[model samples]
Target chain A: MNRDPVETLLRQADWAAGPPSASRVDLADRVRRLARRRHRTQTAVRATAAAVVVIGVGLAVHSATLRHRLDDRTVALPPPPAASPSPEEVAQLRSQLAQLQKEANDLAARIRSMTAIQEQRERLARMERAVARLESGEEVRAQMERAAFTIVYQADRMDRELGLRESALRAYRQAIRLFPETPSAKVARDRLAEINTQGDRL
Target chain B: MVDMVNGPALALDGDPLPTEREDDGLVARLARGDQAAFDALVAAHQDRVSRLAYRLLGWSGDVDDVVQEVFLAAWKALPRFQGRSSVTTWLTRITINECRSLRRRWGRVLHREPAETGRVCSPAADSRMMNGETLGRVRRAVAALPVRHREVVVLHYLEQMPIGTVSDLLGVSANTVVVRLHRARAKLKNKLSDLMQE
Candidate 1:
């Protein structure tokens, strides 16, 4: 009847039985579900990470393209200043110069007409002294007529210099009245006719 | 037969029962994720696994949970089985580890003294074979042993594993198991004199 007491006690302790079958089945099912859930979660995380990577790569490519385009535009700018002007631009510049030349010619013509009147006045003053010394009656009459014509011409030049078109027309009419047959009166008559014909075109 | 032996004598009676071929087939099917194979495996070894957990944890309700944990671990580890040990031995190792973890976790939370006086047997225990009060006292005395000694006692006596098998399961030397068992029996004798009396 001699035996180990601990061994005997353990053999006699019959409470350590397996659990019911239902629990085993339930546990097996729970473990399978957990494994499936883990697999699905891993797949979803991988897909989300892939999408993020693709979006990041696309943005990087797009920015690079935009940068390249900007760089191209900058590089394209420096060549234009070195190039000659196009034919159409040259034609437009030529037209502008011609208009400027026309304005200059008109200004010179007015200045020349003013100088001519001054010269005429000086010649008439000398002619008056010649007439006082001459003995011929016709020569004296011609000098007197010439002096009257020079005075009318001076009035016309003064009105034209003041930019007074109406005053210039009146001065021209007066010149024609005072020296109807003289050369100065004939030049004034021709100018009055030209101004009337030009009218508002001036 | 209580010789105060230095080493555990092999249980020649119930040894050599399950063939290695049968275990190999079951482990193979488990590795293939066959549910029927797993069910068959659990049906065959549930009792042994439950007994080890119950004895280790002093018959707490966590026994069933520990058994499920052990099988689940076995299922996961089947592919790496390498046929080094029998399925029973491998499961026994896992059960012991789970019980140890549960005890440590519960010990921290409840401030358990490890050797507390309490009823170790459930109400369903057979009273005719052993007096319920004496059995409860013996169960508590065994539960009071340190975790290492309790593991040796439970695997040696309750689960009926040999010293070599316990050493293999615990990954320790056979001499270590013998010394631990010798010390554990000495403590049990000191604690349960009334139960040990002829």
Candidate 2:
């Protein structure tokens, strides 16, 4: 091909035509950020999984150790005294039974409290997932209103039980502001005012 | 022409590798994951990609999109590149592939219709040509050619790549490239005839 210098020159001129106004730096930064986030998420998931595995192993080992210790304790404990009708022995036996009963009751209460907390966390997680699926803004706002209502009701009930009316009233006022059409806020306000009046008299 | 048959070292003129100090700096820095090197690579190759896209799409809006995609695709593939060819060759091949893909979607609009309007024209070259004017003009002329013709013209003429190298890039025969160059030059002469007549 006979290369015409002028046409060749014009063709070369076209190569100098710059890229669009969009920043390559921004593009690179975006790529870097996404890469870093991917690394962090992967690391976090592995770390969490590893922690769970470690905790599970530790619990299993501890449970085995405790079972062995219980066996050892049963073996080491002295035999019960002969079944003789004695007043002092009966009294000591009753006291020991009472102590064991008390300990059992305390453990049961703690278990129930822990179970309730876990249930609440699971409920919140479910709500979060539901919120994620609700694409409609109105639906999300309605959910927010319901949450606010429930929070105000719970806070007021807690405050009454715990003797903290002012904080409860503030929560009720927030709920009213968030959803003015609700009746919970009206009843809370009336009750709070009554509490304030009583406090003033005191 | 250097004998390309022996090894890449002897294949100097159509090596597709940049010989400039800045390009050397870029390769070294890029190996180190330097952000500046990546940016520089985009900056350097963007125009070449865009020009190829404009020619392929015939001055369409898809040029910028294709150009950006080409660089992005190059970035992704850069890590895996085994250095079989030079970075310019690798980038140019990517740009050419991207342009062809766009061509397939757009279905080859050769003759500009009266209805088709408001294409983002290439940046107006400074009328006063400086040091790089010869190469620049050749690039512009190559960009104004049809997609198929422009590929060979760019690879062979401006880049000074051998017909065999152009063939590999386009997945066509060396004979096809020679023929395309012949036709492209004829078309270029016709297109630039008005300027020559003036």
Candidate 3:
């Protein structure tokens, strides 16, 4: 009987094959890591929101507490300090006044710190917007000298997008010169050469 | 252009093959978030999947890794399994993509070692075809086929799948599969004959 070629070839394959080195533990761990990262990000966001709420509540309560303490002290003042009130009343009065002064000082200090933080956050938000505009391929060279890192990154991108190798090379060199030993400078130099080589092929 | 002309002609006259009802049901269950059904699918198709990967790329230490990755990708993409194509066909498509990626990585390594082409070269012989030198010649000939012809021939002859099923798996018409198989067989016969005479 003539043998079948298809059957003969099919018989050449091994019937049993095993799985790879990837284990159940590794797979489970990977899934868990993904879940944990998502959870951590959520928790961080909630915590920051909660901190803001807590600070607001603390400021409100402190304000109320100071108002009440000052009111009670004013109402309970000795009658014109007749014949010089007892040493205990004098001491208590002075202590309350001193506390009011201390509370005012503390509030002023907190206000100053809050103002500074607000200013910093506003600056950061503007910088983030500038960075976003640069990323979206817009030219915002107003603050190039002030923000050198962003300027270099945007220049490098512009050079690549415009296909101007020499211009890109110059920007990278400038970045390296200005911010020597910085990661941005190093990355700029590396990418500049990579793009230059690619340009050569063209 | 020739393939495009032939493609529609074959498709119009293609034979209708048996539907992969069981595999389809299993995949549907997997798409509905049933891990058990997905596991069953993996257990069912693991061997054929491994063999295809091994034969296409040669039996390397990475064959099993490729197979596992293929299954994982299948599991992730099961929800998008439109029933237009059979589950086996979908699996074959994914397997081909994975094999191509591995081949590309190997090509990069070979490029880096420009002086030595043989280091990353895939010898046609596999562990299963370790019968004799003649079989090795047959192996090399089959491996040398272009990917399209090679896929149809492998699924048809080596996997012992019906021509219609091979056609469906390849998303091509039965007649196209027929012509490819005919060409592949002719090439193999010629190559094998030359090797045998030596």
* DockQ: the better of candidates 1 and 2: 1
- Model 2: per-residue lDDT, tens digit, A56-108? 56656755775675567566766765434347755765685566556556655
lDDT string, candidate 1, B76-157, tens digits: 7767877677787677778888878887777821222222212222233334235545656766777778889988887788
Model 1 pairs in collision: none
lDDT of 3 by residue, A1-113 (tens): 44545434423322111112222213323333434544665575566557556665765786687577666776777656443445786687678667755765665576566
Highest DockQ against the true fold, candidate: 1
Clashing pairs in 3: none
DockQ of each: 0.06, 0.04, 0.05
Give the Cα error of residue A98 in candidate 3, in Å.
46
Model 2 gets an lDDT of 0.56
The alpha-carbon lDDT assigned to residue A116 of candidate 2 equals 69
Per-residue lDDT tens digits for candidate 1, residues A1-202, read: 5766667656554322212111233446544554565466557556655755665566567557656755666576567555544567557656755665565565556556655665675577557745754755545555544444444444343344325455556656766786687776787888877787888587
Give the CAPRI class of candidate 1. Answer: incorrect
Instruction: Give the better candidate number (1 or 2) by TM-score.
Output: 1
RMSD of 1: 60.4
Better of 1 and 2 by lDDT: 1
